[model samples]
Target chain A: MCLLWACLLRVSRSTSCFSPVSCSSWAAAARRCNRWVLGVLAAAVAAGTAPGSSVRAAPGPRRITTDGRRKQDLAWSPDGRLLACSLYHTAGQIGVALFDPAGRLVRLLSTDPVEMAPAWSPDGKRLAFVHVTHSGTDGELDIHEMDLEGKTRRPVIEERKAFDMYPSWSPDGRQLLFTTTRDRTQEIYVSRADGTAPRRLTSDPSLKQHPCWSPDGKEIAFNSNRDGNFDIYTLDIEGQNLLRLTRERASDTWPAWSPDGRHIAFVSRRDGNPEVYVLNRDGAGARNLSRAPGFDDCPAWMPDGRTLTWVSDRDGGWDVYVLQP
Target chain B: MLCIGEQRQEWCGGVRRRALVQAGFLGALGLTAPQHAGLCSAVAGRAVILLWLWGGPSHLDLFDPKPDAPSEYRGPYPTLETNVSGMQVTELLPALARRAHQWALVRSLFHQQNDHGIAGTIQMTGRSPQNGRVHPHAGAIVNRLRGNPRLLSGFFVLGDRLQQGHRLIQGEGGGQLGVVYDPLRVTYDPVAGVQLGEVQPPRGVDSARAGRRRSLLDHLAERSPTPTPARDAEALGQMYEKAFSLMTSSEGRRVFELEREPPKVRDAYGRHRFGQSCLLARRLVESGVPFVQVNWSTHVEAEEDAGDGGWDNHYRNFEMLADRQAWPFDQACAALLDDLAQRGLLGTTLVVAVGEFGRTPKINPNAGRDHWPGCYSALLAGGGVRGGQVIGASDARGEAPAAQPHTPEDLCATVLHSAGISRTDVLALGLPVEGEPIHELF
Candidate 1:
């Protein structure tokens, strides 16, 4: 896998400025080389005679707990070791805490007056969260970042009069995408990691919020009220070529792209109480994986593509839960 | 010679009488001052409370019921008789029914915008959104006309500000009229039980400190000296005045204190955010505010599978209508009417309860209704309006107005007029076009 990635990177760089003749020749040579490599690997695996394995298989997600606190919005560290989840409190206070693969609490990341929607940096050195002040004030939200040890707290965006929420780190970790209220209406905005040069991405008069980036960073998925109710939508990084992903009377929100970029998981109220559901990247063959009769939200894909973690209230009070494929 | 002299005197007397008659006629028609001045001045000192139903409430289920409509359209709620012999309100409003004599309910308010954003703009601004124009809200208009000395702000929004799409609802703020004319926005979070957003200082800044800051700012201003626009300056000044008033005036603080009210009274208003908002509106009006708008826009959470909590009941119309939605409104609205009357404010204050538009007359398969802008109902009380009266009617199916349809502009005009503003009070937005207040309601 590493060798293939390296070759693809080299080819992409050469294609950037290659002449038409050179590009065609290079493409042909690459195709022939890929075929030969695949043939040899298949033959060796079939014979069980390979001397050393060159590629590691994708890990299956571990099942943490099924007790039902509706654990959602999982963020894995850059080293792929620790994960963080947004835990909903029945008393209406939202907190963020870290957990290991074995479902053990590792550390408490944030205990703000009100915090939810945690996003980890590409380097996993810092965590960004939507810190809410004064409980129900609409525009009292600010984007905050803190180190993994819950130290060195700093405000990434500090115009305290408008709502700044649902922060998502860019693929390069140099920028962030979040939702903010303009003239009393919610819209998506992208800003630098240091909170400079904020630019609006969507101009619709509907409520646009909960922005999530595709793993490849080519597209962004968000929830909007453009259709008179909440539905999932996607737009390219430049905010063009908008597409609707879900269509029904029920509301769909908090979309998270799978690590492989082939599927998108989201919370929907279509079957009554909100539950975790997944649809293909092309928005086809949609299915509900968490069919339990309880409210579920904030679906996050484990590094191992086969497991999902979410927040649910099935056990009465909100707690984190995991599901396995 | 003596007879001719007498005839000349008689002709002179006749000319004087003719001039007197002409002046009297003009005055009676209100083209002059005396005839209508008393009528307008009667409400000059009184306050006005505007009960803004944020999402459009259903007219058929509340004020304008059509019992003969199909089951899907009518739902399960029945119409009940009010104190007025020939009039009836919905069963959800029994408390209001008993006190029907204290309020005048208009059953035919029509507008073109069915969407919340557009409709809200029209209802608040008194101008159709289709006119491709925006105007100041009715309260702002009142504040501009009736300048007050003791009060910090003439107009106020009691809870969360009105919002739509990515914009605050037009007219909810001072538009072209500038921020000085903007309503004092008091935002509060019920869960936190704390006021959020802008808070003006209650007392004047210490003289020495204020002088020092003023001089420093003024020096900076002189260097820039393009003269910040007048509107911007006015808005800043208004903010300063509001901050001073809020921080200094005991009355202002007391008006916002919900805990000061009798426990039973607070409970009677319900523990919900909107119910408390209504209670606060009454307090503001009583405290000498010229205009108070209570916005019911807070997000109320209930059981996940429960019916509608907000008035935007797109689905499960009957279940929401019977159980969750209408009950709180029924209790609080009825209580408000009674409370206002008991306080003797019903006669002086103009209290209106209305939303942007009405719901669809037809019910969808999910037992919900969509947006309907054709016709709706608005209730008006006090400010010398006659009680026990229903002014308009809907067709048999409650689909559209059968007679006397009132536009949002007319309602705004009525509110302004009740607050002693002449229809000709020009709110100079520096635009070419001029706004004319509605005069028919008075």
Candidate 2:
């Protein structure tokens, strides 16, 4: 499979300058080659006949999710023992679920139909997520913090008539930042730990989403489409010191800061399909952490800052994967 | 064979058979009845101009906006106040908002059959396709009741021909009523010019000249010892005569010459094919055609995704509606209403703008609205319709009808009723029309 890919890469480089052929035809050839390689690798891995497997104990990123469901908005628990994510089953059930580091189903936190954007509190005792209930076309979205040990879930930010989503707990756990369309457009907002007294931030006329606080607790990173397509941008807690991180034409979203505050991991379509990419804090030296086929989205940095957990559909369906970059 | 039934003569099963035979005989002699030419002169009576929005449009985003509904349901845009009190439309329709007094809205329109093909047939025919039997198109039934009137056809369909898959969409053509009542299908292009390929005679064959040629051919055929030439001649000769009349008549030619309209008036209708088609519909109605259907676009979903194809909006509904679908519709519809009113044509022309169904209110994960036949909206203007009033209401989320729920057949009945075609006449013709004329609209 590697040899075929290498040959195709060489062939692509040689044929790229041929003006008579359109780029779409070249893309088709590359796609055919990739599909063949993926099919062969999948067969070998399934039959246990391959000496060198892609998911073996090699020195590279490892896939943790294999449930064949759509997993999104992945976040590591404060202690990093488990990962919480929103899973959409093929049968049309959407809920939040927890998984151990080894990718085992720990427990479904909530199967409340329309839940997404699960965030763990800094103390690791509670989970904060958005639970939405729709009535035909009209729906209510509210943030709920669930007690891990009991059924003591309570509303955090119950904006009854708004799409308040993508909640994140501050490093100190006293405040939460979330994206809401309460003002007619998607913008970021800050709320108290109890989800009260919400205050608006980042009031751009365009859509802003997937906000993550920097490890230092002073800056918040989020993706916005204020500049045509979505790109990552960071702003301070006071809504000042705005900085643009990624400016590629392709969509770059779901920004997550490393534990050491040195790098920001994001999902970008720059490489053709969505892939996990890491860039320096100062917006330089960007490199892809997951170069596999299929869509890779919502990368969350582990506490150790060496591993990044994300959801990928490369194995035919979405699963959580941990990459050591 | 043409005897009366046990109950009533008009309700007899052989009425359709007799009608067909009568049509055939008259068609053979080239004495087809001219229809509704005096329809415009009759006070309070009017012709119908149908702006068929092929796919279902989202009611929440356009007519029955739920500003107070939940964020996901209300969508991103704010509602704007129209010229009429207690009425509001989406900010996307500013032009129509200003002209709210000239039109009335039926907000509680609903029907079954969510599939595009089935719903389109039901809405267009005003009767569901039952047991695999296609009903006559509403226009066909109207043309049947009010025969061809001047030298022109009564029903005209302008723009790209409507289709589902490779076949003409159900109800787009004549069904059990026979092809004689089928709409005069016409295609128009700004650069390539108007094409009436099906209705235009061979070059240099004016109406008088074509009639002379037909007589000569008939004389030759009678001399020849050919069997069953009379029936074949009747059908072929009928087509040629209709084509000749349409291609050569001064009135027919004048209605198609869109360059007669001022440049400013043409620009007001937008430069797109759908807008220009609406402009052409006005001309046909003015020329005394009883039913003129202006299709929004030709290719529905075959060329683009759902939303771009006349409001299917299966993917990125907000972006597609905000960018591609809403503005052109608002401009063309508003401009049409203005033009019709200024020319005093509104009093005699009933304009109905609607789609097969409405989009789902609960947006899917793709940010697109799927087909929802449960509830939708239709706009009615002119033909003595009470303007600035909403006929019925949908629920807070614009999901289903809350008051005076009406089906697609009922909407069709309303359109036919506005055109002064009685429900009794429709029933006598063996059509499956349902609902009343929406008394509130009248």
Candidate 3:
């Protein structure tokens, strides 16, 4: 059986030269290998040990949990006791929820109707989202703020036809920066926390979205398609200095600064699939921390700064998992 | 005949003997089976041109305006009188109104699904996706039924095929029918004026070289003994033949060449992606293609200070519709209808314009509309359909169908029927669902 397994592996590797005779030989070898593997697995079960543990251990950062829904745009409370996540379902509507540290659903912030890009305030007392509406003749989407109770909702801006989305509140809760289609091009706009006197910040023809502010509130990181494909970019709040952070030929989005302000975690498809990666503030020392087979996205740093929480589908569904740095 | 040997019995009862006797009996009439039955003469020569609104366009604002409705439900645009008395259309669509005598306006098209993915499947396939799984589009069914004879291609889509969340917008192509029935997609950067990167032939490979390559490939295919390889080689030969024909065919080249159009005519259509696509559709129909679908895509990125251009207008309803969206559509569609009429192609070509669903009647605080799947409008012109007619009606608020409510299946059936293809005769390949073409319009 061992010899047959080895022959089957060898034949499988040389599939480019397969012929009728080799095909029959390969079938025989594969059957033997299957039986041998089954036998080893059975023996391991009897011995109370997992088979192929050594082989599986080579891939670092093992999967902890997952759920089927597409999880993205995640955030953690200031104390790191709860994780806020946006759950995307097949119907195109998004549900915002909070989970305990043990991966248990603690609260359901919103559900059913479609919601776009939900963000928690710095104090985690209020949630900001874009409310979508459409008349028989026209349609509109505007920014709305809701308290933790899902009550006391009010519109930040009441301009019809303009699309305001991806609201990110400042750490001091005095100002907010969001992406809006006020000028026909998606540009970043800054407004007071109460949504007063919105000022357009970015003015390029490129598409800008997913704005996240730094810990010190001096620098803002966002994703833009200005350079052809979506990539991570950072700019000062005053719009005086602009910096390109990523240059890979893949979509890099949803940049979140670590609590310590030294590293940034962002989602990228550079490795053939969406995974969470961390790079230095200056875009160096990039490493894939959530390299699961399925999509691993929407990484947020815990307040402790030692562990990161992200949404992954390693368990056949999207769920929150923590990675210790 | 009595106790004949097996070989003799076969020979005596063979079709050749039967044919000889029949020919001898009908010698003076000179009629064969095919001629007698008129089967050869019944070949379909009709074609259909579809104007696909990728994101759902508002029915109330366009075809089924309800001016008497409440202020919020009534859209921003005013209704205009058409050539047909008592018929009204959006004022912006003056061109379509003038040619109202040439087409039928359906106001009560309805479906169950409001989601773009599901609604699109219903509209394109005439049957909703089974178990919510993606299915082949309608153009694919047509392509498979009638193979592209001129090698000019069968199904063609002129925009993005998919929407947000990777949902398959139906009518784009064959989803599971494999690539053979997939529409010859022509993707472009609408804002940047970039054509499809794939359609361009290899650099320096002229028409003569391409023809030579095709002949070589065909010869190799004929000599190959293996069935699989031979089949693959033949398919490749067909592809090359098509590519060569498409590249060298004067009609094909002329159809895609927008620059050759007179400046006044081009300007009349407005300088927008949808307008350009509509113009291209006219060109393709003139080139003898069976099915041409022009998708009005909503993938335009948010523009700074500019209202949302796509149909998924969820925020600023009046400002966007009046200033940006409706004007370009008005001018281009008007020009297309006018052009088709002046060229005498309107009688032979069927033009259909519709979207997945309509928007809600109640206005939100943001002055925008949400998706409404209960009722909508669809416009049909040419191809022998009765003109100057409104088939159905909506309520005062245009909220629901007040008269005859037509399903996407019904509209698809009408399209097929107009193209001289009987819905009952043509069966969808690989789908378990059954469809019968709508006969009411005919």
Tens digits of per-residue lDDT for model 2, B1-442:
2222111213232123222222222121121223224534432336888998876778888888886776556665556678999988876677898899999999998888978788989888888878888988778777766544343356778855675544457787668766556676666543334555344434334346545654654554455443333433454455545544443334335456566676457667764456678888887776566788988765444122211146666544664465456766887898899988987889878899998889888765444578899899999999889889998899989888999898888888888887778888987977666767788888
lDDT of 3 by residue, B186-271 (tens): 64333333243234444445556655644554454354444223333344345444444345434333345565666446555644
List model 3's recovered fraction of native interface contacts, to 2 decimals. Answer: 0.01
Lowest summed lDDT across 10 adjacent residues in model 1 chain B is found at B23-32
What's the C-alpha lDDT at position B298 in model 3?
A: 37
Q: Model 1: iRMSD? A: 21.1
What does candidate 1's lDDT look like per residue over B1-442, in tens digits?
Answer: 1111112112221122112112111111101122112323423467788878766888888888776776556644456778889888766676677788887877777878877877888788787544655677778777766746445567878766665433555667666565556765565343333242233221233434444543554454345425546555554444343433333224335456566676456556654455677777776666666788877653322112121134666543443454445656766776777777777777778888898888898765333467888999888888877888888788887788898878887787777777776554543434232233333333
Q: List where candidate 3 sits over 4 angstroms from the true fold.
A: A1-325, B1-44, B131-135, B165-171, B175-178, B187-197, B202-236, B244-252, B298-308, B428-440
lDDT of 2 at B117: 82
Model 3 chain A lowest lDDT segment of ten: A48-57
Q: Every model's DockQ, to 2 decimals?
A: 0.01, 0.02, 0.02
Error of 3 at A239 (Å): 36
Query: Taking the tens digit of each residue's C-alpha lDDT, what string does model 1 give over A183-297?
Result: 3446788889888999888875455656988888889998775764467899998889999998865567778888888988987767655678999988887888777654566
Model 3 TM-score relative to the real fold:
0.51
